[model samples]
Target: MKLRISHETTYGYDQPIRNLVQSLRLTPSIFEGQKTHDWRIEIPGGIRGPGFRDGAGDWVEGWTLRGPAEEVSVRISGHVETRDTAGVLRGHREMIHPLAYLRSTHATAPDKALREAAMSLETTGDHLELAHGLSALIAAAIAFRPGVTETHTTAAEAFALGQGVCQDHAHALITVARLRELPARYVSGYLHSTADGQAHEAAHAWAEIHVGNLGWVGFDAANRCCPDERYVRLGSGLDASDAAPIRGVAMGTGAERLAIRVQVEEMEQ
Candidate 1:
């Protein structure tokens, strides 16, 4: 299947500022189950972009702006071809080691509930089965509540509320898996559902556990299934902050408000 994606981010500030820097992880990566035919990223103003690959081998882009401007806008558009491997991403290649995913920044530390969930995780024989079971548990456990959790919400908080968006769900799942000594990574991307159907909050996130034979296998705890062709993987890291599609700081007098738009669709070629 062929997919087309368009994403736009706009920041409106009350006053003009001097400097701004942002890290962007908006480019899709090539894995075992998916292939990248073409992709690109664009910035309108004083922004520079390429591809930023972290120490963990996750590819992203860091942007910086230094000028007397109040508002900034960034756009990313691309197209790719994908296929479903029955949720099995066999031969998936990752440059970084699995243990690399365990390390987390101060902002993404797991909370009490997340720690408890981690302690409760008993290793089943099959990793795939464990992932599936966890996915079902999360779907059944949590209700999709908007504005309940912010970008910085911890896994414990999300688990306690039992209601969160994709970011929260992915964080909870990762904490649980990490406690069991499993190497799990955070995935950021776009989910292409029918426009007339229920709308998505914005961007999407999922979890991928590293299996010995399979390498990296993706599981969508929010949707309770593995990633399919409708899911276009952009980048991945240890937590949501690490893999955020757009993150940056700008120098301004008042404050800056950001608006984001993402549209993903299936296209016939």
Candidate 2:
């Protein structure tokens, strides 16, 4: 399957920003089941991007921009060819060790509810089954509500509220898996299908557990299924904050307006 992705993010500010530096993980690397045919990142000032392997062995691009500016927009456009391997990504060759994924960040803590959930699934020995079971549990536990939680919501908070979007679900799953000594990573990308009318324009999130023999297998708790060809993996990290498509700081701020538009469609063979 071939996919074409076009993502544009715009920010309007009441006052101009003096300087800004952004860390972007928007680029995807080719593994056993996927291949990147063409990719490009476009910014207004025409900035250059540097590539490096992160702690989870995922490819990352840290790009920066500076100067007095009123508005900024970052666009990532790419095409990728993917093969469905039944959710298995084999022979992932980055040097980042598996244990590095367990280190927790401020945004992705498990708290009581997630710990309790992990306690229930204590059979052990099989990470894939455990991850699958966890996905079903998360999907059944929370109702998908658009305005229930924001990007900064915690896992325990989301679990208690019983409602959230895909990011909340993935955060909860990653938190719990790390508690159980399993290396889990947060995945940010586009899910090709959705009940919402804009199936082609959606931002999706999921969790991937590192199983020794199987490598990293993705389990989308929101959809309650392993990722197939419909999933386009853009970036991954310990939590959403690390893997966010755009993260930066602005100098001046009175009030700010933000808008995001993403489109992911299957291309003709």
Candidate 3:
């Protein structure tokens, strides 16, 4: 399948900022499952700086604004060809050990409820089976609803509330997977809504669990399935914040208001 994507993010401030810097992980991943084409990322009037691929094999680019700027915008557009790899991550070069993802973050940290739930699952011993079970549990536990949670909402909190978006589902799944001693990480990316007709934000997220013999496999508990051609992966990290597509800071104290628009659609062959 071929996919086209467009995304824009704008920042507004009451006061002009003296300086600003950003690191972007907005490019699509390079793996056996997906191939990118004509991808572009633009930040108007910003100076491009050092860029590199991290140990996890995700591209990171830097940008800076030197002037007193009150508004800033980022634009991303691209095309990608993807195929069904059955969720298995292959041909992706990375130096980081899988065990590194066993570390937990604030957003994915489990509480008593999460640990208990992980332990209660019938499947054990097989990492692949346990991962699928955990994903199913998360899909059943949370009803997909936007605006019910915040960016900082923890997996435990979302589990208790029983309502959240893809980010919450990914965090919750990562939490439970870690509780079961599975190496798991959060993935940030885009999703073209499927035939299921369940509307999800174009900016999406999921979890990856390291299964024996299979390496890392993606599971989107929010959609109750593994990633396929409809998905485009960007990056991975221990949590949402760490895996954020954009991360930066302003030198001056100006409260920032952010807005984002994203569209991911299937293109005809």
Candidate 4:
């Protein structure tokens, strides 16, 4: 399948910002499951810095805006061809060891409740089955509600609430997987839509676990399935903040507001 993605982010400030620097991980992963056709990142009036593929095999690009500026806009447009690999990440080069992901970050730190939930699960020593079970458990435990949680919500908090969006599910799954001693990390990406080809918002998140022989396999608890051709992986990290598509700081003491719009659609081949 072929997909076209358009993502735009705008920030407005109460007072002019003196300087702004941003790091973007917006490029898609180069792997057997997907191939990039045309991709571009645009920031009007901003200076583009050198971009490189990081240790994790994701492209990292920098941009700077020096100004008494009140607004900043970042836009990304791209096309990719994807194939379904049953969520198995293959042919992607990275230097980090799988064990590095076993260490939990703040967002995925397991609490007493989370630990108990992981310990109580039934497993027959089959890693694959256990991984699937964990995904299913999370999906059943948390009800998908968009406005119930924020970006800063922790896995433990979301688990206790029993409701959240895809980010919550991904974080919770990462927490539980680590509790079981399985290496897991957060995945940031875009999902096309439902199986019936219905239109929906595209930005999405999921968890990837390392099994003994299978490297990293994706599991999206919120969607109750592994990633398929509909998924376009951008990057992976310890948590949402680490894996954020865009991270930056504005040098100013002014209040700021942000607005984002994203669209993903299938293109005729």
Candidate 5:
């Protein structure tokens, strides 16, 4: 399948910002499951900085905006050909060892409930099965409800509430996967489907666990399935903040509001 994506983020500030520095990980991944074409980024009146690939094989670019800027817009458009490899990440070059992901982040910290949930799963020594079970458990435990959690909401918090969006489900699953010693990381990407009645945000998130033989395989607890052709992976990190598509700081005390639009549509192959 071929997918076209359009994403625009606009920030409106009550007071003019002195400067804005943004680091973007909006580019698609290079792997057997997907190939990107005609990708572009536009930031009017902004200076583009150096771009490079990070340790986890995701592309990163820097942008800077000058003073007295009341509003800023960052736009991205791209096309990607995607294929399903049964959720296995293949042909992607990366330097980080899988063990690095075993380290837990604040957002993914497992609590007593999460630990107990992981401990209750039937263990057959199959990491893949265990991973699937972990995802299933999260989906069953947490109902997908937006606006109930914040960006910094932790896995333990969401599990306690039993209600959250996709990020919470992914975070919960990641926490439990780590409890079982399965290396897990957060994945930020796009999903082209909304028919499942799950959280289908234009920007989607999931978890990937490293099995002994299959390597990193995606599991989206919110959707209750592995990522497939409809998925366009962007990047991965210890948690959502680390894997954020846009990370920026405005050098002023001005309060800011944001407007974002995203569309992921299927195209004729």
Candidate 6:
């Protein structure tokens, strides 16, 4: 399948900022499952800095804006051809060891409820089955409801609330997977909506677990399935903050407000 994506993020400030620096992970992953065709990141009047691929095999690009300006915009447009690998991440080069993901970040730390949820699942000593079971359990546990949680909502808090968006499901899944001693990380990406007419928010989030010989396999509890051709992976990290598509700092005390617009659609081949 071929997919086209357009994303724009705008930042507004009450007062002009002295300077702004941002690290972007907006490019799609280079793996067996997907191939990039045309991709570009544009920041009007911003200086582009050097970019590099990290140990986790995701491209990180830097940008700077010397601003006495009240607004900054980042726009990304791209097309990618994707194949179904049945959620298995293959041919992606990375230097990090799977065990490294076992360590929990603040956003994905397991609490009593999460730990209990992980422990209650029946396991057959089969890593693949265990992973799927966990994904299903999480999907059943949490109802997918937007506007119920914020970006900083922790996995434990979302679990207790029993409702959240994809980010919450991804964080909660990662937390529970770690509690089960499985290496897991958060995945940030875009997903084309299914034909069922279910509406989704701008971007998407999922959990990837290391299943012995399978490397990293994606599980999206929010959608109750593994990633397929509809998914375009961008990056992976211990949690959402670490894998954020855009992370930056504005050098002034000016209050900032943000607005984002994203569209992911299936394109005819």
lDDT (Cα, tens digit) per residue for candidate 6, span 96-142: 99999999999997888898899998877998899999999999999
Q: What TM-scores do the predictions have?
A: 0.88, 0.91, 0.97, 0.98, 0.97, 0.98
lDDT of candidate 2 over 1-269, digit per residue (tens): 78888888887788887766777777775576667766878778746667687655566666666767778888888887877777776656666777889988876777777788887875667777777777787888777787989989988888889999988888888887888788888888877775343474677888888877777888888877787788777778788888787777767765778989888888999
| Better candidate number, 2 or 5, judged by lDDT | 5
Worst 10 residues of 3 by lDDT: 193-202
Clashing pairs in 2: none
Native-to-model Cα distance after best TM-score fit, residue 131 in candidate 2, in Å: 1.8
lDDT of each: 0.74, 0.78, 0.92, 0.93, 0.93, 0.93
Which residue runs of candidate 1 sit more than 4 Å off their true CA positions?
A: 47-52, 89-93, 104-112, 119-124, 194-201
| Model 3 C-alpha lDDT per residue in residues 1-269, reported as the tens digit of each score | 89899999999889899988999999999999999999999999998899999999999999998769899999999899999999999999999999999998889888899989988998658889989999999999999999999999999999999999999999999999998889999999988884496654569999999999999999999989999988899999999998999999888787989999998877889
Model 3 score (lDDT): 0.92
In candidate 5, what are the lDDT values of residues 1-269, reduced to their tens digit? Answer: 99989999999999999999999999999999999999999898899999999999999999999988999999999899999998999998999999999999999988889999999999789999999989999999999899999988999999999999999999999999999999999999999885463434468899999998899999999878999998999999999999999999999988999998888888986
Please write out the lDDT profile of model 1 over residues 141-250, one tens digit for every residue. Answer: 67777788887877777788899988887887887777666788888887776223565546788888876677677888788778887777877878887777777778
After aligning candidate 3 to the native by TM-score, how far in Å is the CA of 66 from where it should be?
1.6
RMSD score of candidate 3 (Å): 1.2
Query: Which regions in candidate 2 have their CA more than 4 angstroms from the true location?
Result: 122-125, 195-200
Report how far off residue 247 is in candidate 4 (Å). Answer: 0.7
Q: Count the backbone clashes (under 3 Å) in each candidate.
A: 1, 0, 0, 0, 0, 0
Worst ten in a row by lDDT for model 2: 192-201
Cα-based lDDT at residue 115, candidate 4: 92
